[model samples]
Target chain A: MDLKVEHEMHKRRFSRNAGLGFVLVGLVVLVFGITIVKVRMIGNVPEAYNAAAGLPTAEAGE
Target chain B: MSDMSADKSITSGFENEAGFSDYYALLKPRVMSLVVFTAFVGLMVAPVPVHPFLAFVSILFIALGGGASGALNMWYDHDIDAKMKRTMNRPIPAGKVTKEEAFGLGCALSGISCILLALTANIFAGLFLAFTIFFYVVIYTMWLKRLTPQNIVIGGAAGAFPPMIGWAVATGGVSIESVLMFMITFMWTPPHFWSLALFTKTDYADADVPMLTVTHGREATRKHIFAYTLPLAVVTLGIAATSIGGWSYLIVSIILNALFIRGGWQILRRDDAAAEADDYKAERSYFKLSLLYLFLHFSALLLEAALKSFGWGGF
Candidate 1:
């Protein structure tokens, strides 16, 4: 009976730790996903860069 | 007998006081989601490639910054939140957490996030993060929120800076792409928020928030939404046409813009009486759709970048 009670307590502790672990993992994944999205969309392209740099464009605003 | 039972229930509510989960509820998860999405989009689109570990740190700090802003906003707006039905059950208003605790948490998190960003990333990114926290907490929450109908319009800049910050984290400098991304969010804010304001005008009125709908009427708000959305569609298409975006993105942009414009037009065409009659379901649907629209648009950009990196497409 003593051994069985100890085993149950260990299992409960393991389960609680596992739940906390999952929360930490979820938060990390959420942050990583956000980072990946932001990294994919920075800087001007060749066409727009040229237009902005005034590369003899006839377009009045350009 | 009924009065005694009601009194007992009320007393039991205090006896069984809510806990941490209730306090967490005040962070406004929906607004946080947009902050997360735009900030992520900024980090992804930058020219610089950050190491996986540092990337993780930067994004974590950004999320903390966003949460800190939300906490500070809640702390300051507790009184107004108490009066609004939508916000009545928030941590401060619901008496789950004291305003002082919220303020302290917000300040601590803000400082920690900014310092962490500076340590892990570049100074420019750190400065941007610090500014974003200051702008949201001071300029928006403390000043603009109750003072002007253009609260969202001007205050939206705070929310718009995250992508640029992300870009700076990667590149260690600002560029046109970051500015464009900033513009996209800046323009989208008014229309997205005004739609909610249209549906919840009474809540703003009760809180004395000078939202466009409350100050200028629903018709004017709708017109402004349409006006902003038209230019927004143009900008979205323009960004897609640029080198960073490819064919896949252009296709997605066209489709998304069409849907966005349609939603904006529907909002504009509906009269106030018609909108109010159906509990502003049309306006609410448009608002929800706008959220997904931005997510899908940015995801498409990510997809394009991935495809290009694999040498699957031409620039």
Candidate 2:
């Protein structure tokens, strides 16, 4: 049985994989960008994060 | 051999060979474009401005949500889709994507979009996106689509929510302007669809879907198309009086609404014989106009909002 490795189905499978890779990368970029914007908007450590880190809350520090 | 032939290969028997574009087609990209446009208009027209990046993200998620709903619609309606010539070549009906794949994709995208939109915008906007999906998938697709002649009338609500959801993304709640935007699309759907039905005479009938033309006689559908234009005119024109309204919007609405009403009247006056003789020319023209009608109205609103930014817009 001579099985072909470079069939048209292989091309479609590669395209689908490539598309999924691009989509995942795009999602990561979007999420990172959103996080940066959120952090910039706050301009300080969020109270929950501060509390979680065992640091003074924003109000307490103020 | 070509992929078409390769799809029948012995080794491919166990593996699904659907492509990326097939999955994308499940999203109904054409419909997503309308959702994106309307949602962007809604976001821009809100009194509260959104950050440009946030605005982009919100609109993208809204489009995704809309697309997700389209996928679910396709999944549920693949049977009828197979029957309709317009939809016979859809991913599922064409045998590219299975109905289960479409359903899974729809569910996953719906959840992702709603959650991301909420995290990007606000909870209300996120919740609104989820509700819009539920309305489209469950209410419109599963329940109303096959059961009622008024399917699109009520199902139209699902399509209309994008702009409102966009407004919510900015304002974090519904307002008169957003409701007005919703009404414009809502009232416009019947006439738009019925006109297409007038021309495509057999699609709905053959599919056993209860479209207006299928349930009601041609004359009744014609009359309904004209009647809807009246309210559609009122809503499109009425929005001009609100804060989003301006000279640009006002003038555009008046001209467009007048032409729309005239088009409806033309549709109403024509008989089946006249339409057939002319290859349904009037009906076809009316359908084309209906497409522009919603788009131009929203564009005018966006223009009004843009002018307001420069301190020159609104009443």
Candidate 3:
């Protein structure tokens, strides 16, 4: 015989907690997307730096 | 007596337990929409291109920054808000959210939005967002609102910063086009707000906030509104000559400015006695027009930018 009952406070707070959860999750997704874009757009590195780092460059590779 | 006490306790309990909507109300979402739209236009019209995702993030952060400032403003102005009929039902005054919660939320979001915006866009965009929040919270809300009749004039600069910040997010700096966009909003705020002040009657005076209508006489406020429309029209039209402005913007500006100038003229021509007799119909309609006026102008600029993307947008 389970006698567990939800408290009134818990019911009232559910919406706020859910909203905060959604916002946090959305923020995480946005940060992940930004990270991916930033990593992929690293081609702006100067030719000299790329050469020094032993990375291929358009001018040098040709 | 027992029943009355029970009812009071129940109501108090409900009020004390704020829902998510009450928290959202603190952000003044209506104002945030304007911030978001203008900021989007600023980003789109810039000569430089931004990645679609980055642009979305920049606008989101800018809106967050605007909302954070709004929360801070509500926290500080809760006292005045409680007094005014227009604001008495806000989250704070209505006893839904506490002042400390609002302050904490505002500060946290402000810092996070500014820092993340800088990381996502550029240092200039981040710093500009911070400055805009500071200007709205500190300069406009705390310092000038209660102290001066020119409150809207100076405070308008805070609202006008969004487009400039958007431009910075794209180009990482300002330009004539962005400056012109900022000026359009800046010059338009006085007439837009003063017209509202005219119809709302004693909202400002009742709150003890020194709006132009409170400090200056009603006739003076009217004259100022009309006087402002001239310069507002100039700034609105001036943007059409810039790089981002095009045939669409030019036609929109001409028609809107003509209607705006006519609206201002109608407002200026009416006396208070006549206005009150007609239930402030002229003033009320003028305020309504101001809303459409701003929306259309920005929409036209956005349209021009969209066209230019396909190699047909600008002159």
Candidate 4:
């Protein structure tokens, strides 16, 4: 009698849908983390490029 | 849920069929890359410098906004894609992705990108992102794409909005410099896409889409190509006189414009028999060159910015 092991039989398995879901989950998590940071307003005030008159400065624009 | 899986063609094949790459295609990565680069340049040459981490996050959301536009465009244009030979192999037409899945993906990403942008950047940048997405989907894709030969003309405004959105990321307001960049892309769109129309007019004709070439014939389209490129050159030279331009920028602009004009002339001189015999090679070459043309112009502008940073006479 000859028999194949269950682990051997499943060695090459791959599921595209699951892989896609995993990738999407990772992306969503990344985006979510960035959103939290931005929402909390945790960063330095950006510096203006020019010191000219008659235009909206960075802070004023914000 | 059972009904969704049962209809397989219209629903997400989340258990098996839809692969990672299929989802990626829905984002239109090629278009997204252009959005990212242009947005990055907009931020880089802006009148303010964002915090480094904030800058990265801002561009990431901008890219997501661009991807959302692509997904929504693909969702709406699936039928048009099915009819056109050039687009027939896209995810939806090829059965690799479903319309409902694409639609949901687009809506989700659009909200995520915009909300996060507002939270991270300023409300102006976030609102700009939201408006760009709305314009591309509602105004451009749903309304203009199939209604008129002038569709791409008006629709091009959606594409031109990215740099302005990017500029807002840093400065939180519009400027003449940002508007000039937007104009550069806006004016370039018709001729760039029309060059494509000259050779692939049959594709638009077959799909019942009113591209300029399909509506006006090749002669009229050829004339439009030269007409548009001339003004594009003028707009490009005008931008060179701005603070962002430099000696190197001027040199690149002149050479590119000369070649562009010659390319347009080549298309104008082609007869039906000649175009058919040569497989529209000249027109196709012009189309390919037009792609490089915008990229090089933007890259030259960035180079000017870098040189100016080093006190090399950009202003």
Q: Which candidate has the highest lDDT of all?
A: 3
Alpha-carbon runs more than 4 Å astray in model 3: A1-8, A44-50, A54-62, B1-15
Predicted structure with the largest DockQ when compared to the true one: 3
Across B145-199, the per-residue lDDT of candidate 1 in tens digits comes to 8998999987778888888888888988887777877888888889998888788
**Looking at every candidate separately, what fraction of the true A–B Cα contacts under 8 Å does it contain?**
0.00, 0.45, 0.52, 0.24
Against the hidden reference, what TM-scores do the models get? 0.77, 0.92, 0.92, 0.82
Ranking by lDDT: 3, 2, 4, 1
Give me the displacement of residue B81 in model 1, in angstroms: 0.9
Per-residue lDDT of model 1, residues A24-61, tens digit only: 79757755765665455443455566678887544544
Clashing pairs in 2: none
Q: How would you encode candidate 4's per-residue C-alpha lDDT over A1-62 as one tens digit per residue?
A: 23333321133134455675686796777668766665556344333333244566677777
* The best candidate in terms of TM-score: 3
The stretch of ten residues in a row with the least summed lDDT in candidate 2 chain B is: B7-16
Better of 1 and 2 by DockQ: 2
Runs in model 4 deviating more than 4 A are A1-62, B1-16
| Docking quality tier of model 1 | incorrect
How far residue B126's Cα lies from its native spot in candidate 3, in Å, is 0.3
Q: Is candidate 1 or candidate 2 better by TM-score?
A: 2
Error of 2 at B64 (Å): 0.7
Give one digit per residue, the lDDT tens place, for model 2 in B117-192: 9999999999999999998888888888889999979877888999999999999999898999999989988888
